[model samples]
Target chain A: MTKRAGRERAGRFLAEGAQAVREALRYGQVYEVFVTEIAAARNSELVDEARAADVPVSTVTDRAADGLSETVTPQGIVAVCELLDVSLDEALAEPKLVAVLVGVSDPGNAGTVTRVADAAGASAVIFAGDTVDPHNGKCVRASTGSVFHLPLARSRNITAVFDACRKAGLRLVAADGHAKTDLTRVDLSQPTAWVFGSEAHGLDPEVLDAVDDVVNVPIFGKAESLNLATAAAVCLYAGHLR
Target chain B: MTKRAGRERAGRFLAEGAQAVREALRYGQVYEVFVTEIAAARNSELVDEARAADVPVSTVTDRAADGLSETVTPQGIVAVCELLDVSLDEALAEPKLVAVLVGVSDPGNAGTVTRVADAAGASAVIFAGDTVDPHNGKCVRASTGSVFHLPLARSRNITAVFDACRKAGLRLVAADGHAKTDLTRVDLSQPTAWVFGSEAHGLDPEVLDAVDDVVNVPIFGKAESLNLATAAAVCLYAGHLR
Candidate 1:
């Protein structure tokens, strides 16, 4: 399940650590949970909850738990869960605030944005155009189980995603550094989908052209620009607060 | 320079990669630059800038470059720079907006908050209590050169730091999850110092009691809490927008 190919083939991924395992049991398609003796002792309530849910909980050796974890210091618990991504239509249905990631290769950044989008009450997170898989181990860990709290989708065709967002009555606003409009000046009270690109190279020219508005998060200090996740938090929360 | 002792002993640390090296040259007290032949060729303008600054740019073997870098894929440009931290008095001098990190052990989280604070035009970033060193290699890399763009301070005594902020005529506001006040309701127009704690265990009880105000970033979704950097970004930018 560590490899994307393996996960796709099995239609499952491993959610490691206690928090992830618990959230998987609560809000995700958790197939089975493997826990070390110590982890079972520490998370007895979680194990009981899993058992109550009719999800099988197996106590494995520490070595087996280590094999299933990606972190150096394994939390001694892991869960096999069905991939959680929904279809684009399902994710964006009646969307008011959405976050779209285009060509974001960093798993940590992608996951952090997903978590931020969830915290801000965004309707969905769409991974578009070469973005990292949300189910990747590190991405899942970084999300701290928010991956189970919201709808997520992946689309190779970013243009079609933009069209669908428009069809859902969302104004596509690209968060670009070079844009003339300031983020604060934008009227975020309307249903809006905030489009963000990779931190290295921002939105492609064509993608920027497809957006309804391009706004820059104001940078008042000497820092060149905000990272993808930070910018996403501000943009989504701006819409939420409005 | 990877170890805290080594950096403190030499009174210097390394700025790795092209962006960090460039920013170090532009805004920091750069002692020297080590570059691989390929990196020099790729960053010719940066090399020229170093030369124009009368800084020695030494070309070294890939093996030597690898030895100097913390990253697996070395960008092959590293700059030795003087430590950038200042005294709390200096950092908080006439402050309008400031960020304080208390007991944040994760270098990546600390660095991300530093970058966010910089982008939000915070007056300074003060690492207090048991926080990770701002000079840590991963922290510097995660900061993406913003460490060079702002004033930073470190103090083992978090209480003194808070007192200093109050002494400097700024309100000390702690970003806690269980706070009574919502972040949107805070009067951010006043000069404020936003205090943030580690994601795992939040602000200490006495620390929370000491703050003038405690506010929570509204979580409209099912997420248990926002990560430290995400909360800091929203808090700092709220002050910036005000």
Candidate 2:
């Protein structure tokens, strides 16, 4: 399940670390859990919980756990979980706030944004265009198990995703650094879907034009712009406040 | 310098990539710039700007640039620049807003918070307690040049730092997830210093008790909590809106 192809073929991914494994078990899609003796002892409650759920638990050597982990230091627990993403229609049903990532290739940024969206109570997160897979091990680890907390969707056709959101009564707004409209001026009390672009280059012109509005996060200091995840957090939290 | 001790003894740090090197040059403390031939061609204006400023520019092999970088893929440009930090008194002098990190060990989180604080127009960022050095290679890279744009101060004694903020007429507010006071209720319009803790363990009880007010960023979703940087961004940007 290390490679995207392998995960897609098997419809499963590895959730590393105690926090992720525990969340996976709660989501009720865990197939099996591999834990080292030390980890099993450290997370006795979690092991018991997995056993109660009838999920198979296996003890492995530290070396085996290390081989299964993507981090420099293995957390000694790993869970095999079924893919959690749903269709756009299902995810956007009655949505109030959504976060859309377009051409965001970095797994860490993708996962961080997902975690932020979840914290802000966003209804769903859509990985549009060439965005990284949420099931990627690094992305899963970065999310700290948020990948199991909410509805997620992946679509190659961003336009169709936007259509689906609009059909569900969401106003499409792109967060652009150079946009003339400031984020504070936008009426976020209404249902909205925020679109974020890659860290390297912002939203494509066509995508920006397709949105109902484009708002910029004001930069009050000398820094050029906000990081992608930082911008997403600020924007999502703003909507949450409303 | 890859090591913190070496950087401290020499009073110099390496700023890697075009954005960081450009910012270092603009800040007017660059001693030398080393760039690979390809990077120089790609960033000709940056090279010319360095030469015009009377700073030495050396063309190096890709291997040499790789040695100086902390990333998997080297951007092929590195600048040796003076350490940029000030005394706590100097940083807090006539401050209206500040971001304080206590016991934050992740260099990337530290740098990202610094960038977020900078974008929010914070007066300064203080690294209190046993925090990662702002001059660390990953921290610098993650900051993307914001380190040079704002005043920074580091101190081992977190109590003294809190006292300094209070003496400077700034209210000390810690971002605690479990605090009773919601972030929305805080009067951020006043001069305030926002305190944050490590990702693994939150603020110590003593630290929380010392703050003038402890506020929580309300998590409206199923997420257990927000990431360190995400919480910081939301808190800082909320203050920015005021």
Candidate 3:
């Protein structure tokens, strides 16, 4: 369950915490729920909801729960849910807004971006080209259950994804702080896929060239740039608000 | 050096990584710089800048550098600088845009909000009433050197801080997602101090009451709310873009 290969082989992943597990039960293919006795006693609401949904509830010892938790302070709720990831074609099939994380390895940033994409009413989230697996436990936790609610795809072949987007009539806009065009000036009303890169190295040159244009989130202060997830949120929301 | 009390008593904190150390040397009161022998050899530009500034540059072993690092992957550069924190009065004085972080305990969020405030052309940043210390090492690192570039203040008494902001002729706008007024509709041309709260419980009711108005960043999608740092950045940049 800890290894990516293990989760992949099992065709399932763990969704931890009350909120995320709750969301999985509500909108996702949740198969099993694990709860500590204390948690079962304290969080009757979540346990009841799970039982009402016909999901099996297994009681685990506190020690067992501790072993399964990823955080320093465990929330004592976990769900084994079916893998919900889709293909790039399914993600970008009918997109007004698409959030593409290009080589964003940090699970927190990737998950937060997925949540932001969902909040922005994006059609799909594509983790294209060397991005972290969307099913990673930390990434799933960070998505705050949005991972269960959206079509997420990961592909190493970024070029093909860009070609598909172009063929689908979606403009490709890379979020580069060094770009000449400011975010405020970008016409986000167009069907567009916003691309963001890693915290260490930004977008690759070929990836930049594959896009229609690059846009910079306007920096008014001395800070160099926004965090990838925040920048993605700002860009995607700009399109949504448009 | 690792303990908060030690950092405060010494009136200095470590700024880690190339970018943070470089920024500490530029706009901060950098008293000393530490670089691993390998870092000194590899990062000649930063070493030369430190030497040019007449700051004592001590070469440490790789092991010693690891002790100074707060991140999982150490960047091999650290700066010990005089505490750059200012008084709340100093932060609010003559300020067109000021960002106030209330009860934001996470160093990453506090540091990021400070950087965002600086990027938004804010005159100052106030970490008020149970907020993380601006000089905390992780906060300093997350700021990417904006910690040294702007006026930053820590105050436990938020009430007086709000009074001072009002007296300074700055509107106190709390960025509450549940507020009726939309962020886009807010008049950002006026001098404003944007207030944000912790990741868990948002702003205290009293804190919200003290504000001139509460403005919500419009959410077009299903995600409940923005991260504190991201929400602060969006609000600050909105004022900047205006």
List, residue by residue over A75-173, the lDDT tens digit for candidate 3. Answer: 888898888788777877887888888999999889998988887788888888889988787898888878877788778899988887887779999
Writing each residue's lDDT as its tens digit, candidate 1 over B134-224 gives: 9998888889888998899999998899889999999989999999999988877678899999988999999999989999999988888
In candidate 3, list every pair of residues with a backbone clash. Answer: A220-B119, A221-B118, A221-B119, A221-B120
lDDT of 1 by residue, A123-217 (tens): 89999999999999888988989899999999999988999999999999999999999988887767899999998998999999999899998
How many pairs of residues collide in each model? 0, 0, 4
For candidate 2, the per-residue lDDT at A204 reads 95
Query: Which digits, one per residue and each the tens of the lDDT, describe model 3 over residues B78-128?
Result: 988888888878877778899889999999888888877887788998888
Give TM-scores for every candidate, taking all chains together and pairing residue i with residue i: 0.91, 0.92, 0.91
Winner by TM-score? 2
Clashes of 1: 0
List of clashing residue pairs for candidate 2: none
Binned by DockQ into CAPRI classes (incorrect, acceptable, medium, high), candidate 1 is: medium
Better of 1 and 2 by TM-score: 2
Candidates ranked by lDDT, best first? Answer: 2, 1, 3
Scored on chain A only, each candidate's TM-score is 0.96, 0.96, 0.95
Alpha-carbon lDDT, every model: 0.90, 0.91, 0.84
Off by over 4 Å in 1: A36-38, A60-76, B60-75
- Provide i-RMS per model in Å: 1.6, 1.4, 2.4
Off by over 4 Å in 2: A36-38, A60-76, B35-42, B58-76
